[model samples]
Target: MPEQPQWSERTLDMPPQDPWADQPTAPGTVPTPPPPADPAPFSRGRAQVNPQPHHTQRYAEHEPTGIGWPGAEAPGAPHGMTWRWSELRRGSEWTTAAVLFAFVCWGIWALSGGGPLGTPLIVFAVTLAVAVGVFCLARVVGYVVLERQFGRRRRTARGSHLVTALFLAGVGVADLQQTQWVMDAYHWVAGQIS
Candidate 1:
């Protein structure tokens, strides 16, 4: 018969008990509470609800202006004007740029072996360029004429949240259009080169 396994002498090792097990301790292990805060000083008179006014003006009053700077609010009436010329210009610029980029993309797409839209693409691009350009020119004329008529401080302000939102939206659309335009152009060019 085979030799009997050494089960009689072997034993399994068990894990050690946790130090924090629920056992009674012989030493002190309690925590202490922190000191309390001092009481506020009391005034004897009747309290007035009206608080002192602060000197700081609105943060928007001090924003800067420019072309590449994105959104800059245009100057208007002395108090608070609804439309700022600068903001309009910025919006127009964003629109124009997006349209132009799209047009160029279309042109590129046409040049490639794309389809029957080559001539149409070119026409569309030209029309977009002219329309946007005219709109920009009209804005310039309108601003100059209005400024000449209305007298006061012509200071330009930085863009507001609304203007920024408009710009970002336009840019987002342009970016999406770019993907399609670029892909089509690439295929067209590739087909031609090969």
Candidate 2:
């Protein structure tokens, strides 16, 4: 049989008082009973605990998102290789396209007046038509495609369309001002020649 292990020798000694017991009773040392709890965060009248302000107003309708806006988790947005039309406008696509088209048309019109086939004017006209047509097509296509893919309209977040329109108008004004300066210079040169 295995021998039983011997228990420790017994000794009598009083347990020391807790060191913190005599510390001057902290103010409000009496524990505050936690306020009676309610199952819900808010309640009214008697027995109410942890009441939160009530909100009864409704929110305006907002567009849903799938790629860029809140609650979007598109596989083709800003991360992976999935063809998305919205990606085009993400990198100044429309703005750049508009500017380029304007530049090309202006160049052709300024370099050569309307004439036969292959003339600068003819080229300018063709390009102008294509650019305008394509831009219109792209705008429609972009809204459709992104709407389908993201489940949300591709409009800007806040006064987006208005802001963009205003910006375009400002740009047009600046361009017209420059054109006026150029035409004045041309007139001055012509006057000198005459």
Candidate 3:
């Protein structure tokens, strides 16, 4: 007869109990509230402010002319003009730079045998046109509205974003196989302008 197999007893070890387990504690272990603030010490330097009407700033009867600073605001600027003029101006500049760079990249890609009307080129031009157009249109609208709403330079504040948007959109149209039309329109417009 084969010998019977032997088995040993098995047991599982439990995890350690948490130190913060619910248990009764001595009253001394409870936290105490902070003492009240001292009256005399807290009252120091808390006196009421005294406002004076005469202390307000006074503007000159006549407006300042450039304030001796070159390229500063000319003799005429709309009242209530805030600092946002600078913001719109800078944003328009960056939009112009991005559109220019996209055009350069598109030209280089086409010259490298990425056929001008190929799917990739069309996609590139159209996508770039849409993106640049949206950004520049927003920029143009912003400065125009800003000037109308704030500064007095509404006539002179037209940004480069308008031209950039038109140029980018024209490239996209050209990519759709209408290059001759774009060139003709461009020449006609140039002739009219000149």
Candidate 4:
């Protein structure tokens, strides 16, 4: 059998290696070279525990200032008339459509002999007042329901206005058919306009 190689002779043939070869050394021992300075200008690994607010956020906290109404003044109006008009103006288009629909319906009803014959003008005016009041109440209820179910950002559905207008038109047409006087007046007006 051949003789085995000795462990001492194998160690003698290799050069000595240092354990701290990867660590950096300071030149002339000057404050350890300031810890070899961070390789990157910003730390990419760590996350920000406390972040700063954006610049625009500071300005957004302030309330806006401007004229409430332009080119409109109430010289002898009531105390709350301007505020009431502002509220009315700010109402949604759907509410306006509903109020208009109510007026149209009231006119048709009045023209179709819906009120007392003794005092026709008074009856018509009363009917109109009641119709408008009911319609305004209904609009307020609708807005409240929508705001409660959805958020305040919700708007009236387009289909609702279409449906309401179509129904009122149908009612008006039926009422107009029953009233010969209104039909005659309408025809006379159309002929004069043409």
* RMSD of each candidate relative to the true structure: 24.8, 16.2, 25.2, 16.0
Clashing pairs counted in every model: 1, 0, 0, 0
Compared with the true structure, what per-residue lDDT tens digits does model 4 show for residues 77-169?
Answer: 222212244344443465456546655655665656766655655654664465455545555555555444432322334433344444444
Please tell me which model should have the higher TM-score, number 2 or number 3: 2
In model 4, which runs have C-alpha deviations exceeding 4 angstroms?
A: 1-84, 90-118, 153-175, 181-194
Best by lDDT: 3
lDDT tens per residue, model 1, 1-194: 87766985576774557753345444686644435735647545798899878868645353554432334444552334335666555445455555556555545545554568757666565655555455545544444555545623334322222233344345444544446656677689999999
What's the residue-level lDDT of 10 in candidate 1?
Answer: 73
lDDT scores for all predictions? 0.51, 0.50, 0.56, 0.51
For candidate 3, which ten residues in a row score worst on lDDT? Answer: 151-160
Question: In candidate 2, what are the lDDT values of residues 1-194, reduced to their tens digit?
Answer: 97765554345564557752344445778755556656956555687479778878666444554335545565444323234555444545445545564555465445444345456456446654654455455555555566556655453322222333344444444444446555677789999999
On TM-score, the candidate that comes out on top is 4
Candidate 2 regions off by >4 Å?
1-118, 156-194
Per-residue lDDT for 175 in model 3? 49
Better of 2 and 4 by lDDT: 4
Candidate 2's displacement at residue 136, Å, is 1.7
Candidate 3 error regions (>4 Å): 1-100, 110-117, 143-145, 157-194
Q: What lDDT would candidate 2 get against the real structure?
A: 0.50
Clash list (residue pairs), candidate 2: none
